[model samples]
Target: MSSRPAPPSPPRPISVAELDLDAPDGNVLSLRPAPGGPAVVAGDVYALVRLRGRPAATVIGTVAAGEDPAEVLGALARERLVAAGPRGDAERLAARSRPVSAGPPPRTSVVVATRERPEQLARALDSLLVQDHPDFEIVVVDNAPRTTGTRDLVTRKYADRVRYVREDTPGLAVAHNAGLAAADGPVLAFTDDDVIADPHWLTALTAPFTADPGLGCVTGLILPARLATPAQILLESHGGFAKGFAPRLYDPAEPPADEPLFPFTAGSFGSGANMAFRTEALRKAGGFDPATGTGTPAKGGDDLYAFVAVLSAGFRLRYTAEALVWHHHRDTWQDLRNQAYGYGAGLTAYLTATLVRSPRLLPALLTRLPRGLAYARAMTAQRGEPADGGVPGEHGTHHHPWPRSLSRLERRGMLYGPIGYAKARVTARRHGRNPR
Candidate 1:
């Protein structure tokens, strides 16, 4: 017999406090400062409460049981109701939020997980060496590569700033965990070896922590170094987050998210491609999960999961659009397709896990599926059958043409997130193996 469906959950209490302020739409939003005492930021909008300061029961997303906490705080921040307090407090908060002192500053460590992409790895390491934020160490966790050139290049050229750790383990999380152990710093910053950081990447990434005592994790925006592929063009056109974004924070707390949320606004979610974490919080959550990322059958949701865990544990998670990096997009169609499938699978696993934790989610989950598929189809169809490209600006970008048809197709596929997870699970079971 088939298993019985889970019971529906009761409506959650309002997780926020009513504040006396109007929203962006001029609607009044009830706001409350997060419970367990606020971290006085002086001039900032939200208080930076630390993980240690909060009760064990209060996860990052938990509400205070009356109104939406994030909504209220955001409204206050926007209205500038949050006082910077005194001038001394503002400078202190600013000092804490800024990057470590520039010359021979605190020893910040960077962890990188690399596979066969030697060129990408090289560029990433080069960027680290050039950061305006000084006094940092580099740890390159070389996953089981087909060749040993990654080790050779690091040791020969970037030996002073780098240490090579070899993890025969194939998963990205495993490699990252290995790096975590190898490095020693108050803060741990991570960047994909395939990405290039801006000169201010480290400084900007570390800046927020100093501003808010409660800040535990920070993420930055990712721009495509090359948005030349039909895959990328399609992805970005659908608000691919390349234009800088943030997440909603107070949408009825259920799980801790890597991104923040607003009552009516959506921001960019945290990308593992560009993120940093306080060393202590990173360790408490047991690092990244190996079962749900690119190196596994699920293909890639570990970064967000880790961020959620941190927030759930009562640590503040942040996204800094200013701390930017340029990631190289896959040029080939097959690679792009695979990447899309992998992305879908990762999202599915994340949502599925959420459903298991909170069964009353049928309304939101089911409602979102078809909308996702419709988006994918429309994106791909923009590719317009066979074409050299499209009319100027039709494909996007100030330079080059884009295939509108395929762009729509990819967007539509994203909506079928649940379907992708199902397919991934089936493939894993049938093959009894995970793809590399």
Candidate 2:
């Protein structure tokens, strides 16, 4: 008969405050000692609560084993999720680790705002279906599709896990609102159907709320699925969608910046491809302004506007790199150019919105314009120079000057975004199109 190895020495026993999970469906979990298993019961979810109610030292999920609990907690903390585990000795740990009195957990919802792409959408749905967190439901809002494959894929492979919603509206933001209205989760995560989320994406994305009561939203890092194209490489080189940390609820009214920018910024920027928000927060923010996103000629910026509103409402925003997702970048030069122009247009919209509220930021635009032009000119001249023997390469410019210039102009344009948006608001009023 096969014998199992002796159980490892038990770490110092610690006490968990108690398992308390208030699920949204009127389910309540109370921690009660189980006869032969982990202490603490939460309906189907049982907690072993080892080492004095602390998580076992053993690591879980796709991360490497023997990983430091602190690092794991950091990953969770980055997402602003609840993280409570032992630190030093059992006694020392007890002083700091406190089990949170969790209110009813948010019924998280997933919305995939998709365009015409089907293959990528299939991959994204596959990832969503395989998520370890199962409390959530998904809505794939078809945004004026050129093909019907997205609907078909959902009906076939993900019939159990997904609900397909078709929004004839052509804009990405509009499609997202349709999904938001159709969803039931108190918290909502919106991802482009073109991206693949790591299995832990949902958990990490929702962790922040568990830690801080005030946290209203979470944004995760978006690594590229493939960085083969020159445009993709260039975009990454310039830190596309990769943002420095910023504090969201930081009342400039507050005394000092206590936290690093990663998770707590007013404009906690992240790719629309990988971001989550509380559903109540979305409702309060009025469900993504359609004028700012893809529905308009401007390709994107809805996420930024939503982030801004969440911060303005005095809620915290967090960025979790461990909650990773991969986005497929446009492969062709033409696609890249189109993306660049669309981004510029979107920034134009965002800038216009920002200017009306904070007029002082208006000067930042003028300062950036000269610097942007200088960089563009220098890059253009270098690309214009022949690769060898003064002969121009087959591709007229080794690095296309126009896209790069347009990218710079777009960034510069953001400095003016608020002013421009405000101007547009006034102009729209005269034209009978309500800008607000």
Q: Return the top candidate by TM-score.
A: 2
Candidate 2: residue 75 lDDT (0-100): 38
Q: Tell me the lDDT of candidate 1.
A: 0.55
Residue 429 shift from truth in candidate 1, angstroms: 15
Poorest stretch of ten by lDDT in candidate 1 = 50-59
Measured by TM-score, how close is model 1 to the native structure? Answer: 0.59
Q: Supply candidate 1's per-residue lDDT for 209.
A: 64
Write the residue-wise lDDT of candidate 1 on 117-192 in tens digits: 7777988888878888766778998887789889988899887679999987666666777788888887899889
Weakest ten-residue segment in model 2 by summed lDDT = 387-396
lDDT of each: 0.55, 0.55
Candidate 1 positional error at 153, Å: 1.3
lDDT of 2 by residue, 211-323 (tens): 77677778876654544455654444344454422222333234135533311223335768878888787687566755557655445667776776666566767665545
